[model samples]
Target: MVSKNQIKRITGLHQKKFRNEQQLFIAEGIKVIQELYNSSFEIQEFYSTDSSLQLNNKVKPDIISETDLKKISCLKTPNTCLAVFKIAPSKPIKYEGLTLVLDDIRDPGNLGTIIRLCDWFGIEQLICSEETADLYNPKVIQATMGSIARVNVVYTSLERFLKNTKQPIYGAFMDGDVVYETELPTTAVLVMGNEANGVTATVEALIQKKISIPRFGKLQKTESLNVATATAILLSEFRKNLSGK
Candidate 1:
C-alpha cells in the first residue's frame, strides 16, 4: 500500500516544477515503464497492481491494490504499473550530423511523436527552446512510447545555439524552397518552428537555408501541416538523400 505522503509525491510529479525539484518523474503503463527499465534510466520505485509482475531483483515493485494504484496514477485508466525514475543526466549534445532544433514546440503529443521520429530516423541530437514542452511530462512520456529512452533532448536558447553552430542551418517554412530539390547536407541542423507562430524572427534570421515540404493537394486550403507530421516527412527526406538508397 502506498503511503499518503508517497501518493502526494508521485502525483505531484505530473507538473514540471515538482519534477525539476524532485529530479524524478513517473511513467505509467507496462510498456513505458518496462522500456525505461531496459534503458539506462534509473528506477527509484515501482508500483503495480499485479503481484506476479517482475522486473528484476533490483526493481522489486510494491504490489498494491488497484484502488491504491489509482491514487497515484495520472491516467484516467491507470495501467498495470507505474514507476518513478531518476531523470538521467543530460547526455552531451553532439551537433555532428542531422541535429533537430525545435523552436518552442509547446504540444506534448507533437514533441513525443517527434522524439519517436528521431529515434526512427537515427537522428542523435534534439535541441529545444526553453519554451518547448517538458520532456518529463507524463503525457509526453506516454506519447513517446519509450522512444524517450533513446533520444537526447536538451532545452536552451535556440538563438544562442544557432548563432554558435558552424554547420549549415535549415528551417521549415511555408514559402521556402522545395525540400526535395534542395540538396541537404548530412552534417547539418534542421529547425522546426512553433505550431502556431512558426519560427520566431530571431531564429529565422540565423537560418542559412529555408526549406518547405510542398503541398500536393488543393491550394490555400490547409493552413499548415502539423509539426510532428512535417518532422516525419522532413526527416525521411534527409535520411533518404543521406543514405542514397
Candidate 2:
C-alpha cells in the first residue's frame, strides 16, 4: 500500500514545479514503465494491480495495491500499472548523427508524437528550447508509448546551441526553398518551430538552409501542417534521402 505522503509526492508530479523540484516524473501503462524500467533512468517506485505484477520480476520492486495505483495516477482511467522515475539528466551534446531541435514547441501531444517519430527515424538525440513542454509530462509520456526509452531529449538555450554547433543547420519556413530541391547534409540539425509562432527570427537568421514541404492537393487555404505531422514528413524525407532503396 502506498502511504499518504507518497501519494502526495506522486500527485505533485502532475505540476511542473513539483517535477522540477524533485527531479522526478510519472509514467503509466505497463509497457512504458517496463521499457523505462529496462533503460538507464532510475526507477524511483512502482505500483500495479495484482495481476500486473506477474509481467516481470527483474527488480526487487516496491509493490503497491490497485487502490494506491489509482490514488497516484494522473489519468481519468489509470492504467493497470505506473512508475515514478528520476528525470534523465541533461548534459552537453556530443554531436555525431542527425540532430533534431525544437524551438519552443508548447503542446505536450505534439512533443510526444515528435519523440516517437524521432525513434522511428533513428534520430536519437533531440534538443529543445526552454519553452517547450516538459518531456516528462504524463500526456507526453503516454503519447510516446515506449519510445521514450530510445531518445535522449535535452532542453536548453536553443539559439545558443544552434549558433555554436559545427554542423549545417536545416530549418523549415514558409518562404524557404523546396526541401526536395536542396542538398541536405548528413550532419544536420532539423530545427522545427513552435505550433503557433513558428521559428523565431533569431534562429531563422542562423538557418544555413531553408526547406519547405510544398502543398499539393486542393483546399489551398491549409494554413500549415501540424508540427508533429510536418516533423514526420521532414524526417522521412531526410531518412529517404540518406537511404533510399
Off by over 4 Å in 1: 56-58
Residue by residue across 1-245, what tens digits does model 1's lDDT show? Answer: 89899989898998899999999999998788889999988899999988777885456679888998888888999898999999987787775888999999999989999999999999878999999999999999999999998888988899888978889999999998999999887789999999999999999999999999998886769889999999999999888875755
Task: List model 2 lDDT by residue over 110-139, tens digit each.
Answer: 999999999999998999999999999999
TM-score of 1: 0.96
lDDT of each: 0.91, 0.86
TM-score of each: 0.96, 0.93
Off by over 4 Å in 2: 51-55, 60-67
| TM-score quality measure for candidate 2 | 0.93
| Every candidate's CA RMSD | 1.3, 1.8
